[model samples]
Target: MKIDKDRFNNFIHSYTKDELFYRSLYNAEREHPETFSQYVDTLDRNFIEQHQLYVPSLHDSWFPYISENEFFQTYSQNIYIAKHNRYSPEYLHKHEFYEFFYVYSGTCINTIQGKKQTCRAGDLCIIPPETKHSIAVFDDSVIINVMIKSSTFHGTFFELFTNNNALSHFFSHTLYEKTENNYLLFHTQSDTVIRSLIEDIYIEYYGHKKYSDSLLDSYLMTFWVILLRHHENHLESFLNTTHQNLALPDILNYFQANFMDITLSSAAEHFGFSVPHFSKLVKDHTGKTFVQIIRNIRLEKACRALKTTNLSISSICEIIGYLNPEHFNRIFKETFHMTPSEYRKKHTNL
Candidate 1:
């Protein structure tokens, strides 16, 4: 199952069946507007896949919200990667899985939450689950999509980017919360190492050797590490298509590192923002007040400890910033609808 480099290159260079059909259809619709309806009605049944046809609506064509179960089979692995369809103008649609879209070549229009971004070569966009987005490539362009199942994402990859840094904090929050309109972009067009690694990933995925699965995971891990290590300066985060959060990641990282003792005034001073402006920024970017964010971080740590460690509830509370046992118990029960001991027992048995 060894694929030569030249062969793999040729395979990707050739247009797929759906891509050719879409290109022809697009050309016909533009050139022969009067006969387009008749041409569409008389389309050759076998020219395109039945499930891949684009349906025109009263106002516009749309793609439906796709669920993970429908896209990934039960027996398949958690990760899926493929080349995006060329010449296809995908409409606004949400999916119940994470997608990493890498612009391999040329430029494509990426619309996220109704705002458009022209993604050029080597622009990597990380789209979280439940985010409404669309990608349109009218001309020659190549986009690689690396899709991860939502469950797998939470279980395995969640900790990969939780380090004490601005970029890591961005991923930690984006992945943990599954925010609707958040995405991370990396500009790595000049990085030859990442480009080669992506090619290797593609080869491993398509060649399908016996140990390709494990190798793919290693390659992906290396990919992430390389980006975090070498490409930190090239990173950007977007709350929506237009609004960029340049400093929010570092701010969130500061909060996470000092969740036990940080106060609003101290945080504002550290970030060099006035108290009210800092407070407003926190609310606007995170949709959570400072207290709420701290509580959430502490509670999250407590839940992890309850599930994995043999610590007593009091010790757990102390470690996660709770001073009073009664207060910890009340808050834990309020959040999980059960006492810490009960919650621990439930997760332990499962």
Candidate 2:
């Protein structure tokens, strides 16, 4: 369905918060005089049409239901039941929310950031914000999908991950193998505990009993602590490398702020180091060459622009610091496995 750009813009201007958009439609209906009915109808129809395409819909057999109560204000989390489906579209296809999923009944394959791994009945998957992921059900599945606001964890557990380059690298690239004591996949024993916790969450979610939201939030926090403990234990070994001593968080910040004007020599000079030393330090920390890191950052910006802006591919490339269109196209294709035009077509208005 084509978006009514005028209507969408008007809707945005009318609502202060995303949560109020629906309520605003109702208020607009009751308060506005002439054309009120038309405004409400258009808002309702446009919202449904726009979201229907953006959010993934499992086949009818999946039996998906969601409930969010006013009391549950910490984060937006929900339970999903997917009976059987080959795959669900990428969650980040339209939004950049951090997501977590706990499989309850059957096996599924999760593809995140281009890496694939099997997530079984007791396994849990955590997806960082802006990471692209899709799920393929191997059998009938019941899963709880929790979408946590970035702000909720931005300064807490999320900061822990971002503080260490190795941890961030592992999360960003979808590493599945156990490193040291940390295993992305739970041990059989831990899996059972996590499964029980997930079931408790589901019960609290659907029950909606008095104080249920508080109980559910507590369970989520506990589950996160467990996961973080495992991740931290496993990541300790990688943190011992020389690259860890170079202060990667600062470097990442610098790269992000100056990506539009970044050069290898300039980056090295920023850290008060020789070009070769700084390059090696970055390589050691991220396991990506300096050029690769810069390219990845540029590509990420391009992806965001493609999804959220009306700019043409050439314009996007220029905005993201690529002067040569052909060179940009080649790199974009190599990184995303699709041309800029295709990416824009798939994600625009989503």
- Clashing residue pairs in candidate 1, if any? none
Which 10 consecutive residues of model 1 have the lowest summed lDDT?
A: 55-64
- Model 2: clashing residue pairs? 182-234
The local lDDT score (0 to 100) that residue 23 gets in candidate 2 is: 46
Q: For candidate 1, what's the RMSD?
A: 8.0
Candidate 1: global Cα-lDDT? 0.75
TM-score of each: 0.65, 0.41
lDDT of 2 by residue, 1-350 (tens): 12233343232223223234434544464478577656744554466555442222222322122222221222323222212222233332313344566665566777654567777665665554444456664223555566654333332233245445444554433221111112144423245556566656655565546545346546866876665565444322211122233455567666766787799999988789999988876776566788876786778678767766788888998998999999999998986578999877865543
lDDT of 1 at 143: 85
Off by over 4 Å in 2: 1-244
